[model samples]
Target: MTGTPLTTILIVDDEPQIRRFLRPSLAAQGYAVVEAASGEEALARAAEAKPDVIILDLGLPDLDGIEVIRRLREWTEMPIVVLSVRSREADKIAALDAGADDYVEKPFAMGELLARLRAALRHRLRQAGEAPIFRAGALAVDLVRREISLAGEPVKLSPKEYELLRLLVQHAGRVVTQRQLLKEVWGPAHVEDTQYLRVYIGQLRDKLGDDATKPHLIATEPGVGYRLLVELAGDAQR
Candidate 1:
């Protein structure tokens, strides 16, 4: 896959060995890799380099990766995947709640990491670009009008819920983190409020008649966040 025109990825880790191990492998897979050794540097490079995705290490010499994620969420919607030695679910949830799109434990498989990176990039692209109006079953979403309907009935949502649902619809097939959804809907100030997200998501699911257990439209990524798997057919023209 060398020179295959893959997206650029930034690797933020204090460990030289990690960067060394990742660079060649990522390059071999056709990604342009940039490295930053500290949170400060990562933030600066992210602004300047504008990497399509970020592989962030939670433990840094100068700052916590969560803080870095918080700061980055202020201005950018770029995908961030947390890489940490801490395998605890709480730690992973914390990162996910802090604007990380996904988390990977240390000593991870290179292929798995790369695959995750690709997914993140795909999600970002889907979110940023112009999305076609979508329909799945009786549900319909019009991107141009920012409207939604279910079973031939107009569904009303709060301003925040509408924005959140729009974002999920844009990224239809991909996972979106709580932090990303919060930032998009409530702004950066509310990124830490996971409960706010829970309530809004529940409201959305109820409106869509989505089953939490066997959800056909809205899918949850456990401790991560929610994704709306919009089925694009039939009612799109409406």
Candidate 2:
């Protein structure tokens, strides 16, 4: 009988060097690696391989990485993490907005990248199997009851605060952009009014007791958005 299959990760990049660097590193970590040199090939391999997660490079020889993300999102929700030399804030926002799960800038540390991969995988699993009660360490949100609790104690929040927290909880472990949050919470007219977000986020954070300096719950992504960090339900170590 065959043994358990390794979790597969598709590496899509135009540069041969990046692929060469990542393959062995990932394989050593017990991952089955798949490679694609261009956007078209990446799509083809994605369809054929049905890999668990994808690491995509934005500067592709054929299709742009954002477009590739759009196309793949059309068919599969397979987690896409963009590994790009493009460190511009706009590119990061565009990629995240287009459905990429995470972004890793060039000249990245292998340890950080590996941690991101694990986090992305965990995020995908969380999305696939959603629970009514969402837990991230000491934080917990009861989706069905519209309740908020931290460390087994009930937490009270205002309407706006609850909505903001609700949105964060809905997309736990993912970056929700300022534009997206502004639009959803305030409205199109208020999308440009970022002060509302600042005020509300502050209130929400305070109520949640999430420290701004060393945040445990909500993390600010600096000129991008916020990512609600997550942990195992029972504090299970990964």
Candidate 3:
């Protein structure tokens, strides 16, 4: 929100006061603002305006914010930061699991809100042009070479295992839905075969020495898909 100019931001909230409050502040930071008062409007404006980031309110008139996140994620990877009055930690987890990048409660500090927005945008941009080589802790994956190593020692993987790992690495920090993983890795015919995916994931974990109980490399989202918990070499956490 602070660094670059002309970065469009979509504000989705039913309340005028909240929109008014954020409008000038975001504009002052050199962001172009688009407003939507309902869930339907939010989706429409998102496709039309093509905003760089979205500040979404959970209690929209039409659709729930979680649904919006899921629908948008089907085609787009734009950053979404939920700004809502729901203070329950469960709501935050649900939003993130549904594909929201960040969450901010109402009556929040303007500075902190702006800071979160900036971080989300920065991370999205980093994922846009991901490096061929990815690293987390001591594990390294050379995506271009289709090779993997742990603590500088070579690790071999089967064809299916490598494919699954590659998909997770592509969307490192974000949750990848089980359906998306199934269709991409095993093709459309095997999308309903969740058990097949479970077997392969377990196999990949064993080869990578990743413990499912207290996972450090691959973390599962229960009913959702997996996320690579590794850090990209040059992309430090903001």
Candidate 4:
């Protein structure tokens, strides 16, 4: 019998050293590596390689990674895990909101970067109908029935709170920007209303028994957005 096909990963970074750095590591783990040095090249290569995942750097000679993400999203739903030197939370939010699956800062630990890559691949698989339930620690979300439970006990949530949590569950392990969450849940008119998010998130936390300070479930991304700490997993969820 033939061996399983390797998972192809596109490394889109203008820096040769960065590409060099990632190629061997990824190849060693049985991934087929494809490299692109510019956003334009990346677009072309993505079409040619049909990589299973993309590891992108925000600084490209031709176009910003965020724009690349948007352009790629126009046709494909492939997972993009960003690798950027940019430390600003705004940058992180921009990438995540633009359709990237995850982000890892520059000078990142190889272990962490590898973990993010694995998570992104898992996310794509989930999107492809592999996972319907999201779970992390004691939290459980049933996408089919729009049910949520903590430590085996049902947790009740109001409409807005449930909507927010559902959105997070949909993007589990990835950051969902504030404007995105607000616009999706509250409507376009409320996109800039941060206060509404704060109030509702607090209510959601209380109902889920997630601590505000030492949160174990939903972790606030400071000024960026919120990320549900799930195991890469679902649906309309009501």
TM-score of 1: 0.62
Give candidates' CA RMSD values in order.
5.8, 2.8, 5.8, 3.5
Q: Across residues 1-238, which tens digit of lDDT does each residue of candidate 2 receive?
A: 1136889999999999999999999988889999999999999999999999999999999999999999999999988889999999999999999999888899889987886777778777766767677777777788789898888999998887888888887777667888889988887988778788988898888988878898887888888888787632232122
TM-score of each: 0.62, 0.92, 0.64, 0.87
Which number leads on TM-score? 2
Residues 1-238 of candidate 1: C-alpha lDDT, one tens digit per residue? 4455667899999999999999999988888999999999999999999998999999999999999999999999899988889887678777877768777789999987876676566566656655567666788778788788888899988787788888777665556777788888888999899999999888988887888888887888776777665432222232
Candidate 2 — worst ten consecutive residues by lDDT sum? 229-238
lDDT of each: 0.81, 0.85, 0.83, 0.85
Error of 1 at 51 (Å): 1.3
- List residue ranges in candidate 1 displaced over 4 A: 1-6, 134-238
Model 2 segments beyond 4 Å from truth? 1-3, 231-238
Candidate 1: C-alpha lDDT = 0.81
TM-score for candidate 2: 0.92
Candidate with more favorable, higher TM-score: 3 or 4: 4
Give the poorly placed runs of model 3, Cα more than 4 Å off: 1-37, 40-51, 55-59, 63-77, 81-123, 231-238
Deviation of model 2 at 88, angstroms: 1.4
